[model samples]
Target: MTVNPGHTFARIAIVTVSDRASGGQYEDLSGPAVEQWLRRAVAQPCEFVRRIVPDGVESVRNALLQLCDKDDIDLVLTTGGTGPAPRDLTVEATHQVLTKELPGFGELMRRVSLEQVPTAILSRQTAGVRGRSLIINLPGKPASIGICLAAVFPAVPYCLELIGARKMAEALPDSGA
Candidate 1:
């Protein structure tokens, strides 16, 4: 995975797992919210790919596989389908494709969300590594997206570097030129 691709930029894929969003019952706000947050937090240029999938194991799992395996995305962020409901299956789908499970990401997100809402305990957010890509499951609400992301995003760049997703120094343009 040549994450740098001769430039200091990142390719991020946002997958929104929601039946309502996918079925056009409502607009996909959560996906856009994640994109907005990343654009503000990340310094480097970013190319974003967005997808909406219904809430199910197969739908979420297939989307994740395509993004992680075929899209060459450096980071994949999924919103929705992490709750305790019967339809919630983002965590399970994510687990199916991950080579390494990073439990800390979910723990930190739940802990931070718990501070804002007691029901946060029901959220089952998780994160893991698939090949060179890092995939994270986040709560569905647009309001909660920023809170959870802020809690975990500080480590994202470092995690990506550790996973060989990108090298900070290599990604930088040569100043001597």
Candidate 2:
């Protein structure tokens, strides 16, 4: 894939999986939260492709695959469906379409979350690479999303670069004559 520097904007897909949210019983905070965080964190311009789906493996899997394969989304972040609940199938869905798993992301996210809440262990947040897209599953709670993103975002840019995205130069001091 050719990296379009002019298209410096990252195409981000935010998916929130919750039956209630999808049904409009409550606002989809998770998706918006991710978009807010991305807008703040990334210097590159970004466009959000958002979705709110029910907690079903097939739905999650299809959404992920479509975003990566068809939409050509650079990053797909999903919230909800990563818990121990029977409907929590995000991790499995993510694994289904991934060519390779990035285990460190889940480990690091859990570790960061564990500092804030003991029940963080119950979270099964995970990440993987499909084609050139990187998919990360996060907790449904807005706060946990922020914490996890902070813990993992440092590596995201580098990972994107390694995946053949645009190069980000390390800041250097210039001596002006």
Candidate 3:
């Protein structure tokens, strides 16, 4: 499968996992940051679905599954719950629902973040695929989202194509040239 650049808009889901944010104790900057970055980077038209959930493995897992399986979201970006803290279960929850893991996204995110903070090594941000959707876990900080998104977005369009959202017209070529 190949995604045409002219294909219809993609549906994106943004999930913010923070007990304080979910409880109204603090505003969610991370979710908006993700949305803002998507707006700037994605050339294709897109719709964003936002959610703020508590920091728990089940909550994160359920939200991700629902977005991919039920909402038919093309991409799901999560913020917060990616650190070494006790409540940081985003990586684990993501691991549970993903059909395939994309370790390079996490590696590149940390690599880019390391330029600003040594603590970047402690973050557990990750990415994976569930059905037709691609899910990426990002740190809570707005700065980190920009760094990670720049590092990994080069592959997003191609990945979306491989997942069957669009098509290419190239004739079949021999596997071994």
Which candidate leads in TM-score? 1
Candidate 2 clashing pairs? none
* TM-score on alpha carbons, each prediction: 0.91, 0.90, 0.88
Model 1 bad stretches (over 4 Å): 1-8, 167-177
lDDT against the true structure, per candidate, is: 0.86, 0.84, 0.84
Clashing pairs in 3: none
TM-score of 1: 0.91
lDDT of 1 by residue, 1-177 (tens): 555456356778999999998999999999999988777777667779999999999999999899888777888999999998999999999999999999999999999999999999999999999988999999999999989988888778898888887532222222211
The C-alpha local distance difference test score for the whole of candidate 3 amounts to 0.84
- Top-lDDT structure, candidate number: 1
Off by over 4 Å in 2: 1-8, 166-177
Q: Select the stronger candidate by lDDT from 1 and 2.
A: 1
Tens-digit per-residue lDDT, 9-106, candidate 2 = 67788999999999999998988888887777776457789999999899999999888887768888999999999989988899999998999999
Which 10-residue window of candidate 1 scores lowest in summed lDDT? 168-177
